[model samples]
Target chain A: MRVSKFDRPYESGRPERHQLRVENISLSFGGVRALTDVSLTCEPGEILAIIGPNGAGKTSMLNCICGLYHPQKGRIMYGNHNLARTSSHHLPKMGIARTFQNIELFRHMTVLNNLMLGRHVHMKKNILTALLYWGWAEREEIENRRFVEHVIDLLEIQHIRKQMVGSLAYGLQKRVELGRALAMNPGLILLDEPMAGMNVEEKEDMARFILDINEEWGITTILIEHDMGVVMDISDRVAVLEFGRLIGIGTPDEVRENPDVIRAYLGQDHGGRS
Target chain B: MMATTQCGVFHESYRSDMQLRPTTWQRLRVVVVFAFIIILPFVASAQNLRIANTVVIAAIGAIGLNILVGYTGQISLGQGAFLAVGAYSTGLLMHYYELPWPIALVLGALITAMFGAVFGIPSLRLKGLYLAVATLAAQQIVGWFVRNWDPIDGTKADGAARELSMPRALFFGDKLNDSEFAFYVVGMIALVIVAVVATNLFRTHIGRAFVAIRDQDIAAEVMGVNVFQYKLVAFATSSFFVGLAGGLTAVHSTNISFERFTIDVSIEYLAMIIIGGLGSISGSIYGAAFVKLLPEILRDVGLWIADQGWLASGQLDQYLPFAEDAAFGLAIILTLIFEPEGIVKLWSDLKAYFRLWPFSY
Candidate 1:
């Protein structure tokens, strides 16, 4: 459902979104190579899922794109800005948003506050105005609150909007995490394990929300998720990782049949190599 | 999921939901509180009014401490030093420059904020106990400067005197001299302005940013909060309120001394916020009053015990003075033991209990 609000002031005259491009990035800590010359490109509005076995550097690759990790080599570009060089703090303003593998919510605050914080980059603030809470701050807050409410509606979290996020159930927390990333109104979203440790039903719910967020907002999604069935069903393109190396990068069907992907990652259920 | 803050009450709009006080009971409570404050001077004695003024002034400082320590999750031990900076700046502006007290207070708060921001520099690189120690240096350094600096030693030329005194301020046209009732207007105004400003601050993005920085700095940073800048802003905002308290204190007594704003004084303000509630604005007021009043009440209790022949009168006199210090220690211990989240949790629990009052469900 389209959000009914027409007075989204900042949504007007928006610049065209830039495609995310990662060119041969490598990352290491001390002596351990977390990612080795990993390179991939995400078009402006496609969901690219990175599938890998445990310890296959999926999170690390997502981290590099979000500026949480600076690559030792290769250029990570989103639009014109180099993700490797730009401060992680600046990424949100540039319309880059992400959720964590382990939820990093402001635990003390309510769900409403957490979601409002997601709009921090877009909210205009002047300390004097904020001190009085009179004009610009109030206007920005109401406008943003209206926008965030639509996200709440989208995620079906209207019931728990006032609940403290820290006290919520795990599946609920994951949904709230996604809602927070969506609250950024980002052009590009990198979800690091958006659905992990959930019942099949909750997984389906999260998957549907992912699809909705991408299709409704036209947000370019770079998702790192396990659960191959869900990933293959939802993603437009799939990249396979093994031992810090990209073995295959193509459509879900293309990667499914690739001999290296099956042998390295997809062959876990079978006793023999593909 | 269908529950409401009040069983029958529900918000119809986001604007109503965003309100600081949305309920009829809360609005009435505010009006009742203002009425009580308005009637207080008439019923209270001059000495009682003086203490009330002191309590409110302490409330201002405690609120300041809460902003940094509780809300922002930035620990501060320099509360006393920041207060001294404020007190001294207010005193200096009044004595040397002949500025009016209100202007002096405003300027003093600004000056104190600068000091707060500068001392808060180490916080960007350090936190917790390390930040506490770094801020402790502010208390020491400012104390030393007050004692040693010839110029800061009030209006005395002998250089032996450490206390500074200022003439009484004229409020609107009348002199606020000698009467606690008159001086109370200044304290009340400062408290109201501060409490409102502080409460308003948290409802907006700036206040939320402080909380975000405190709760999850990395997430906040990635989510586009300038963590370093917000941290400094927290320091400055907290110090500004502390300074206002100091300025009020200056106006209340029309004098200042190093002993008055000592390390113990700093610890007392810290104790106020801790005992009141970290990050709770009202808890600051409650804490300041609790910290200030409990000791005096204990002293009275000590005297009453002596009067009632429960203890030897002369024998108790020697230790009667220690009752205040003893009360401080006891209050902290009891608060930690009974309500670790401080009085704020107790208040919330009380509200929750009443929310389902018909049964203990």
Candidate 2:
């Protein structure tokens, strides 16, 4: 659960391994600015954490990356794709999967069904084949179920496989949401407040799962978490936003010691958690 | 209650696990229902057989509506309009082109499916009651077109009626003997096929996506489900079944009119799904039976009351229709109040109560 900078072969080659780049992005709603000239890069197979106080456009930045919002100006380059032109429906298919801040598991569906839905892009059966539910459809289903089952196992949600997601506790629902994103088998995973509203035990479990997803699966992750302790321990890079501006971006240790970052946290009396 | 929940029920393989009816009791129940339906024509009178026919037709329409309004969670008040599209297309193909019944049926379904998809385009941007109102406009537009078009020659002078009859619903190169026989054979077969497809649909990837969209469109979109495409598919799939049912109705009744596919008819469909159980395939049949038969039962009650000298025949006639409509309205209200989940839940509850009798736990 500790952030080991040298355990991985990424630090020296970080710039060369850049997988996502957000440059000169400005977004607004009506007359209020949400994000302005915000820029950051996520290297391959590393956890990049975004920390900000409330109303600092942290969620809006994630929304911009996943094509939920049109930023009015700037470019979001993910590999060769421009995220500004990508729609939400196309995000997962293009290897970008995200979990919402609030749990968004399909409430009436079983956890298995919700996870299976995460494999929507992977399953290629047409309507005719789906109607038969045999041969090609059955084959595709079993193949995808193997992946979903792996996610279920990884997230330790086997006990609630058949249970409706709506009836679950909030922490379990959040885990199911992460399992859903994992089931997508994406190259880049965007998790918004993955450990929000969890007890210490649940938060520790989530932190471990996030690390496992990033290290073991080689999946690039952009995480937004309020627990500075967990963020400092897990993240390879940290970006700080305040009042719609990127005030600092660096390694967690470097960002933590910056005077501007210190002043920003103290200005809000945010307990130096940032 | 724990007896059934115990871990004795076993599936030996993946194929068995995916079975629609995994338990012997469920299989037996399905067999018994089909057997009873197959044997009903011999024991029942022709009039009663026609009622069965109507239920079968309505059940197909109800199942279609359920796919849109139930599984997909899209509110549609335009199901009847889609039915009209099927009926008219099939009627025209039969009347002018002289196509076979099967071709006409398939083509009619496809045409109505296209119309349904077109009407569904607005659904991505609109939802809930607003979407319902937009679909209501579809109903109005279709109704107006059918009433005023007069494309074929069988229009009555009043313009309200059209002699939209099937020459004879030919089954395996043999003509159906009568309307009762048609319902017994053609309608029953259609119901079985549609029920099977509709039941299997919810088990597949596409069906799950539809349910996901219904539960939460934003989450479905984020999960790689093309919400817009799936919603359109749901509308088209629903209208296909309704249109096919409409084709069956056109052939069985040998007459068609704009009044048949009115807003009231669409609301009746909504009631059927709600009263039957929103997301259950078999519930659609229960709902269709309840809705289609209630008016007949009420009319009989009204007639018996008049015969008992409680009222003059003229006065009874004046109020009888109102009584039937009022009874329908009351049935929906009562169903919503007592069992919002519908008759399927009620049936299950009753079964559970009986199974756990004497203990009261």
Candidate 3:
């Protein structure tokens, strides 16, 4: 809420972090319901995982919270603001950032540029200064780039920092996407299936990165992952959805023992993917 | 802190690491090219200077157009129309209002920026070919207004294009009387400023927002890039350059006419960016040079053929214009068919191939 200087450490660095509260939000496309009366609170600075089968409206739920999809029914609140009224473009300015289900990086740009782009909301705008690359623009650029370097370091993407995002491997692209979201320095991060296509080693790396993001920066993470093993390993809490409804929401062990969650998700597939 | 560089080179600070031209070799190349540019006027004839001015002006305009269609992925068929706005605005300001040429030129460009933003409004709802068609409306409307409005030297007949002249620019009370050479230097300066500004823009977050929107709009929006705002900014920025080009055309040619900037000119601008390279800044200049030079080269070749007795002079004259037009069409087709990425990519590939000479395949 304090909007003065652009060069604050990160949104997560701010002391007054607020939790995301989604209240009875219902979303549907024609007759097919994407999310039906789904309501859950994302606690500040915790890695919360939402796991379900395909078309279970996990991304839709994220989208509604992201302002990409406005729920037809109830209010989704991020701190003091009602997200229904907040435009999607202003989400990052409000300290909210999300990565996509598929890698949605600026393909032609190098990894550095993509990460710097995540700093878009924070960058001061002065065309004359930017064009001349002097004073405010030059000083601002080096400062933000210093932050992006930290992200590249955190994600261990030092080697591919200058490589074009398109030329990078799928796992690397996903990590870069996460790096981009991290570059925003958001208090809350929505990651849609960050480990969908990764191999086991890649998955483990992504899991560690996700945990580091949550623990070190205290970035509240709402991760949608299908790999239950990875999900249970990293998530502080688990929310299970089936056919557009939340079957259960609790700690990983509590969700694993829930009767409905067992029948719907864990029973069909033991510790691996269903 | 230590930083990585080409084996021997090292960057010890962020400012050093983030330099536009970090290496000695790169700095030397820039200085050498600038030195050559400074000496060019002394050696080149007036005719060559005139032609080079045209190419430089085209490059400026192409850079603008490329920012919209090529970099930002917003197709505009109103480039020529925007050019007319610049030309006529500068022409009217200099002639009737008697404003200083520099002030008039800047005002003219700014005026065209407003016009571009007005036309770009529809882009929020339209895209691709649909957007192209929408922009074409600007070409028609501007063309119609110039042909009908009396202040702009309107003519009753359809093909009768009236010329509106602009006064010569006075620099420190000097008339800039070196003529073609003066215009060439001015054109080169403008080209350098525009190119450098664009290059600087792409390195920052503003430029990243434009590319992000182009690559993926939804992601850009969610990532906090105001998509519609940036699209309008692209339109206005591109028009500022294009309008500057048009204003220069008025001052350089000393005459502005509707006939000179028709839809054909708009298409030519599009071809320049397309043949140069999409989403590449330097590609705009390359494309502009190729397109503007194609006709001149064709004419010279045609004249040579006639002089060599391969074709009669009278017969060559009859088909020369047709040949030039056909060559333009053919060049675009050939470029698209072979190197769809355009001349920029082709030039880069050639450099890469030759980097490891003789022994390499």
TM-score per model (chain B): 0.94, 0.93, 0.93
TM-score of 3: 0.93
The TM-score values for the models, in the order shown, are 0.94, 0.92, 0.93
Which stretches of candidate 2 lie above 4 Å from their native place? A1-18, A268-274, B1-6, B158-165, B172-177, B303-316, B351-361
DockQ of each: 0.57, 0.40, 0.47
lDDT of each: 0.86, 0.84, 0.85
In candidate 2 chain B, where is summed lDDT lowest over 10 consecutive residues? B1-10
What's the lDDT for candidate 1?
A: 0.86
- From the highest TM-score down, the ranking of the candidates is 1, 3, 2
Q: Candidate 2 on B1-361: residue-level lDDT in tens? A: 1212213576555456566677777789889998998789889888888888889999999999999999999999998899899888987888778898779988998898899999999998999999999999999898777767667455577555555555666776555436476556888888898888887777778999999999988888888889999999999999899999888777765567767888889999999999999998889999999999998787788788988999886987799788878888888898999998899888878766776676756
Error of 2 at B144 (Å): 2.0
- Which candidate's lDDT is highest? 1
Candidate 1 lDDT, tens digit per residue, B194-301? Answer: 999999999998899999988988889888898888899999999999999888888777567878888888888888888888889999998999987886677778
